[model samples]
Target: MQATKRPDFIDQQYDFAAYIRNPEHNAAPDGIETRRMAIYRDLFYNNIENFAASAFPVIRAITSDERWHAMIRDFMVKHHCKTPLFLEIAQELLDYLQNEREPQADDYPFLLELAHYEWVELALSISEESAIGEDVDPNGDLITGIPQLSPLAWPLSYHYPVHRIGPEQIPDGETETHLVVYRDRHDAVHFLEINAVTARLLQLIQQNVAASGRELLESIATEMNHPQPQQIVSVGAEILLDLRHRDLLTGIHNIPER
Candidate 1:
């Protein structure tokens, strides 16, 4: 028997392609082609594909198997995501669908919006950045005229009504929607349907751009255009306190510290 020469191509990369397609070429060191390699390959790809597909099941269910396989293959080759957790694959796919601005933009106009909507549920579900807010000496008194929003809370609005968009409810055209994705005390995911004005107010509060509770309320009232602005301010103050109680506001910090 002739000795087979080792290829120069072996490097740091795991050489998954060779392992999957040409397992005989690189047999196990024990001199037998173990069934474990095929098992591993099937599980690896299937796990990733299943995990990613689960996040966007509605989209996946509608898509043909051929399209899904092609899409996943393209993603596998093109994207070099950082996280090993299968759950994060949805995020990377969402980012690729959203931020990929090129000639191919027309190919998937609503794709970005859909992906964004899909990511909302997953984002709130698996977010490791838990609530870091602590109670002050005076819980209610600490709520001065200023309040800070939580680091984990996100207020997002999308051009497409995501909550309604599924295989069943998908309309002929895109519809706008507003969403607030936040983690509760139990670390459970919660979604809220907030109005555009409220969403904007939450956005400003989350970004720390609006310094004081008064500023947030005034901005909201001005943007929304209510009859009495000061009246809204008092109402907004109560809302801010409610948000604080919900752990939505971390604490009132200086504008510079934000």
Candidate 2:
């Protein structure tokens, strides 16, 4: 069958939206007054700009107005967001920063990482998932059982120390940063900066989901080639307990840890 022609009204809608997105290149649809078109342009742009501004306030604060407006324009012109919902603007901004936005000479080195860290905070804050589900025992023994990471808890690693990126404390050098972002039972989101060992331990739990706490620690000890495996296991037990206390874990696995 031959391809069906698109209706003129559909094409007109596309033309209108394209111009609103980037009036610099695409011409305004015919028969509309420039003054009226200006109103539509400003209204559309302002709504998007304002929502994205609230979504990424730190980005707004750290960025100079001229630079920030220029970048936001770049986002509007280049990125095709999948959703029109205001709540998803932060995620769209993060996607633009990571995948689409071209780097500028004045762009901060930590810009992408900072955006990701902030996006995680915002995403977890609005997530509907419960911290401790019925399957998870809030008071379960973490050391003797197979500990499970919570769905609400996200383990993240970055080359830059994103949590400390601010006006006065801007980092000039790279530091390996590991954080577990989680929402607590009280419905508060928190970021916990952890050492490489603890980060690796969390990874181990996810990898060996059926392994008991002692087994996981032993595996870590073996991975580290430590001569004193028992000591590593002992310390790891305490670490598991600490994570459990902080609601970082979803209690012990339902299957037997032994």
Candidate 3:
């Protein structure tokens, strides 16, 4: 049998992979030929690591710096993400926490929501497409006439008030927050605190239910034992008018188009 001879490419590629993963693996190439390759590999990983660190300051703040760096190192080794956008890195971290990380749900049930809420702000700001609400009649009764929500508007209730989430305020048990997240006519993001009834009403209108704004208000009033559709609509219409003035209504026109 011929004597075994190591291929040059095998040695180079081995050094390349190791140098890429960590600088400590740098072995003298016995020549200046391979030194430049190792330097380039280290620089590439450093740039990537720095970018990830900057993109996720809140997450980084939640962990010790050493732990944070270690976390990023392991993540780089294990996961292959599809997006090159640094803003999307939080999404990947969230997915990892949900599927792979073992953070206790009782103590950190809101971790996922916090990440998502933070990401939402960035997502809306960078979205390439935008939409504005359709024509709406402010004088029309909402409970009697079906009201349509803006396509850019959303009502989201999270298990935790993620806006308040941080290392200091994170509760030891589950919490909930009711919020309306929407984009205005100028495409700026706006968030509001809303009650359960209002959130449900928005959901119903968004689903294109036949109930009019006045009818919905009356239902809310009845639940509170007020039982007056007209009064309820009067108050609800004022609220809807404010939302419309703010461009939160996609369309509020009454039926029959008069």
Candidate 4:
């Protein structure tokens, strides 16, 4: 026996949703007034476009309105967002830019990286992770004790200076930009420009959470083959202290001297 057919109303609903999402591609459902359909389409598209503009203001500023609208419309029609949360929509755009969408001639070189930088700020602002525990000493020793990088801290490396990119300063040549983005106890998100050495040091600390400041510095000094290993150690000590003060390194694990 043949299976029963689905209701026409269901098909109509699907057609309507598709049209609302991408009126440029999908025609409006039959029997819907053109005026009413226009309202729905405008409302849906405007909401998404506004959200995207607010999330990536730099991108909005750089792109022409026609181009921006087309881009957002394409994203709305093509991208299948994973999360229902509105805040995650920015992430969906980032994923779309990074993985799904092909690079267009008019697109900025740092478009994806800049979107990612913006999304990081939003993600950190809404993060549920608590600050360092009360038991952790903020002013603990840097050399002897194990250093713990905060879950809120993130080390980011980009091919372009995403933080500095704007309508005026566009990327010209190949340049590596390293940044550390973190949230402090006050619930404020901060961005810090870092050098390759500092970036590598943060990476090492993140990978080896149990390593002491001195041990990490010694490894770095050895890696660099510095003429003055002691100087590296001294500077590393200062860096760790500064990181701790900024709440990026929550605290140190106090271990008794051997």
Winning candidate number (lDDT): 4
Q: Of the pair 3 and 4, which is ahead by lDDT?
A: 4
State the lDDT of candidate 2 residue by residue for 1-258, as single tens digits: 999999988898998989998999999998789999999999988988898778777777788889988888888899998997888988998899999988988889989988988889889989888666566766777776678888788999999998877766778899999999998888888999999989999998877657778888888899999999999988988888888888888788656533
- Collision pairs in model 2: none
CA displacement after TM-score superposition, residue 173 of candidate 4 (Å)? 1.4
Q: What does the lDDT read for residue 209 in candidate 1?
A: 47
lDDT of 1: 0.66
Better of 2 and 3 by TM-score: 2
Q: How close is candidate 3 to the true structure, as a TM-score?
A: 0.71
lDDT of the candidates, in the order given: 0.66, 0.86, 0.67, 0.88
Q: Write the per-residue lDDT of candidate 3 for residues 125-204, one digit (tens) a residue.
A: 66664454356664555556778777667688897776666678656666667887777877789888887767766776
Q: How many pairs in model 4 have backbone atoms within 3 A of each other, for residues 3 or more apart or on separate chains, i.e. clashes?
A: 0
Looking at model 3, the pairs that clash are: 134-250, 142-213, 142-214, 143-212, 143-213, 143-214, 143-215, 144-214
**Per-prediction TM-score:** 0.74, 0.91, 0.71, 0.94
lDDT of 4: 0.88
Sort order, TM-score high to low:
4, 2, 1, 3
Per-residue alpha-carbon lDDT of model 4 for 1-258, expressed as tens digits?
Answer: 999999999999999989988877788999989999999889988888888898889989988989898889889888998898788889999998888887898777777888999999998999999778555667788788878889899999999989987889887965899999999999999999999999999999889746788999999999999999999999999999899889899987776567
The alpha-carbon deviation from the true structure for residue 209 of candidate 3, after best TM-score superposition, in angstroms, is 5.1
